[model samples]
Target: MTTDAVFDSPAVPGVPLPAFVQTLLWAGWPMEFLERAQERYGDVFHIHTLLFGKEVVLAHPEDVKEVFTGDPDQLRAGEANQPLEPLVGPRSVLLLDGPEHLRQRRLLLPPFHGERMLKYAAVMRETTAEDLARWPRGAVFSLHPHMQRVTLDIILRTIFGAEDPRDLTDLRAALSKVLDRLGSAFSTIATIPPLRFHLGGFSPWAIFQREMAAADKLVYARIAKRRAEGPREDVLSLLLSATDEEGKPLTDPELRDELMTLLVAGHETTATMLCWAFDLILSHPAVRDRLVEEVTGAEDPQRLPYLDAVLKEVLRMRPVIPAVGRRLSAPLTLRGRHYPTGTLLVPSSYLVHHNPEVYPDPKVFRPERFLDRKSDPYTFFPFGGGVRRCLGMAFAQFEMKVVLAEVFGRVKLKKARPGPAKVTVRVFTFAPEKGVEVVLEG
Candidate 1:
């Protein structure tokens, strides 16, 4: 699959900025890129970013159907998202194609299933409780950082059966640094291709490499220790027990890559969702009051009505993952447009989530829409769509609801300031730039 399409064409015709300038208009995309492009053009269009140096097609639901579910073989997850492909390594399900993706998904699916996910509810409840217990009453603090810590703990307990909170905390901090640096780094560094030796790309990537080495030493060491300790019911044990169609156990590198994929995918994005949810409810007094009402009468925060709706709406508004990219595996066309194979397409969560056609008054944050009816599942994808949908979606939703439940139920917090005042993306994920600061009154 290949394309002769040159990125020189503007983001859309008659737009003031070149595709390049429009891409660079804001750091790491102010909103989803396609969204800004739609404002400049209309539904169907293109957006450019320096790093990938490619133009991605942005589509509305009518256009997106083809790209997302249209031809699974024809439309593929592309190299535009390749930066992390290396870190996640070759066998990561996220970086695979067709049959390979299916196999990895099949192998990875059982442990993340219904009965299994139910076990995390208690972990979520207890972890959230532990974190909420330390919230200093009347003191303003950034919630996302705390949320990150909480999510990591949940992941450790659920995925690894980890109990030493301090060790997990250290691992989370180190991994957090690596992820935060990669998503949005300074201009020059983010765009460069990697070499065996050369210390620039994605903000002191050498330092990141050092951190990776340090984290790897720790993670792999744990893997060995756990191995000696004998079989357990955690994700690692599950992976060890998994057999491919060929009946082979996952290679060591495969195991590490899988762990990294789950760690990075599950950690930052869910934490961002919580951060955005905290800001969303705190800023909108009505939403907050309603949530308090729904959960107040309930004996447990996790069981409250409208709770999941609230999280979905939060994800819809400020989705943790702002964009997703896929390459053309086979030639395809959509929205009356044609493209050759390997044409890079980027989907904008910002635009799709804000599409007034799909979401009425897209700007307003409302949870009622979800309760009203079933809408197109593909359109409002925070966990992404298709087979590659996050392996941790259930875990993410559970963590968010459980943490929010515990906090809202026990810790009463109010936004310390006014306005969204700058709700934005950090690197690739959406988070408050000023950090969603709030004061806990309970």
Candidate 2:
């Protein structure tokens, strides 16, 4: 899918900074950098950077629609996600394109089907309740780590079918180490060419390698045990029985990669987004009160429109991942303009969600907007869009509702620092800066 053919540079305005400088800004403070670029260059802009190359960022909903619905063959999302390959491995659905990607996606889709969430709901609710009961009452604490613990436990039990306490503890510790390191601020250095080297065990790169190896050992062990024991309800069991068109089951390496993909992608993103939910919900008393009222005595919080709307608004206001990208392998027309092969075309979810035209008073925390109208796919895609959209989207949202219900129904939380939310840049995600500090009000 590569060629030596040359094409002219994109016709859009570009970020007026050195490539390295732009790389640093984009890597370190992506939302801030993107907002500044949008303000300066309008909705359509380009930035040439060392890390991601020439990226054409599209923020207008129409433009976003074009990229989202564009041909996946020509718009190779897998290529655009190379930085993630080291973490999720090459066989990961996140790093596959065209036919390979489709096969893997189909195999992975069954476990995350909307109806399947009902089976997993019990695990989610139980995990959330148990985690919340341990939170320090009437004292300020970082809710992010606690949320992480809850979500990780849910992922372990519901997704991995991890029932053994010994295995759970080992897997949890290993996986947490890997994610904590990968999601840390300094993790960005490992992505840069000049800065990405190992200086023995203490080096960031070396330490990540060690943690990943530890996690992989536990994951592979689980896969083997599941293979021997036969099918159960969890995602791993379903995947173990899954096969490609040729009727071949996924190999050990493939299973390892996909499991790692689910853990790394699902764990932190869901936890961090949950943190944003509390940050937003507590900041807006009316919204919080209405949400609590809706979830308090409800038989199923998932069916509560207001609770669903609250999560929807939280995703809209603070998307965990700022953008989804596709590297063009053939010339493609977007927003009435054509981008050549090798151009990384990105649909900025943060920018589109914040667009005043699409969302009036976009900065306001208003779940009622969703209650009034259905969200347009292109305008509100926190889980991304098109065929390559996140497969775990439904599961994550369902899990969020269960956890939120447990929180709002059982306890009242007030933000320790009541103000606008501050975003911290992990390597690839947007998280609460101070972990969304909060206190339980009796």
Candidate 3:
């Protein structure tokens, strides 16, 4: 759609039409929602619609940061995220806004930081090592599902304790099933009304809610049993004892909501990131060789700087969450461009990461760019910026590095296909479209 043909109006200056927005919403549109705009117009052009109704797209880093920071409250990931709300409940920390968002960030950051996170390092390394051992040499395995399962287990173990690993398995399967449904669910259920009830059977939300309720039973049972005995050192134990401004314990529902939120939001995003990393590495022989050389250089494997760059590169090239959204609280001008309240300003990771000026050779897999390039803080925001930024950032990075180290250190992945293969993205998420088959040789 041309700039003039889009939903631009007198009331909202420089905006596009709703008719153009509806055109993009048709099923199975090639490329992601943002990429389609990038291809049609330059990186800075707009898309008036997506799965979540109407919005504008900004691929530039400065514009992107403006959405995240200057207008954090304006561009939010909200209840409109239908498929996610069920597992996390109505009041997950992920969906909170403004003062509530601040409070949750404070409460959530401590367990995921400094000394507390260090305790999980050994667990991460051990888990990665153990999981990679199961990958048969030359096997055509899908890393996306494997990474999800592993991260699910890691989150469960870190959040709960190792005492009941089976509980983690059940929760993983339950949450995965719900996510799979959402990823596949189309119709009025996905857009328009956001249905919570089904005519013949339980709705998607209902199935997920039942799973969440079952998972909560396990959480509360563990908490009750733990309290009956003594204090423990896990997040569940900490949250059980934590008070919210008022010196009262976190309720069962709140605890369960947070637990479920972390598992679903944290695991899925990171696992998608890792799968992208594998695809990026396997495709480029030189990058793969350097990563392997860096990772395998020590009696004890090292944190290879370039390998870290490779992961950063993958995240940049194929960011799982393509858009970081915020809604306007009070109307304002961003870079002298005015927008109305409730206007959805999307700072697209797809655009920002591929911004040629900020990231030279932005399309290529150059982990070196992150280390070598000069850029602003917002220029590399795989995790969203400002106060509402992801609390699990450190944990996700740690897990990604550990997993990458495990895979690259042990075996070399020879690409199974003859030509270059790219991951196919759906909505905001990206995954290896072919499951990334490769020959894993020792």
TM-score of each: 0.90, 0.94, 0.87
Which has the better lDDT: candidate 1, or candidate 2?
2
Q: In angstroms, how far off is 366's CA in candidate 3?
A: 1.3
Clash statistics: count for each candidate = 3, 0, 14
**CA lDDT of each prediction against the hidden true structure:** 0.71, 0.85, 0.66
lDDT (Cα, tens digit) per residue for candidate 1, span 307-383? 87888888888876766777877666665566667678766666788888788999888888888666575688777
lDDT of 3: 0.66
- Superposition-based RMSD of candidate 3 using all C-alpha atoms, in angstroms: 3.8
Q: Cα RMSDs of all predictions?
A: 3.0, 2.4, 3.8
Alpha carbon lDDT at 417, candidate 1: 90
- Which runs of model 3 end up more than 4 angstroms from their true locations? 1-6, 10-33, 39-45, 48-50, 71-83, 186-194, 200-208, 244-249, 297-302, 418-420
- Candidate 2, RMSD to the unseen true structure: 2.4
What digit string (tens of lDDT, one per residue) describes model 2 on residues 1-442?
2211222334577786888898788766777898999999888888766756778888888888887787899889999988887689989999999999999999999999999999998888888888877999878899989989998999999889998889889989998887777776556566455666788667777777777897898899899899899988999999999998899888899999999899888999999999999999999988888888888878887789998888998999899998888988887776566666787888989999998988999989999988978889999999999989999999999999999988899898899987857776776788878889899898
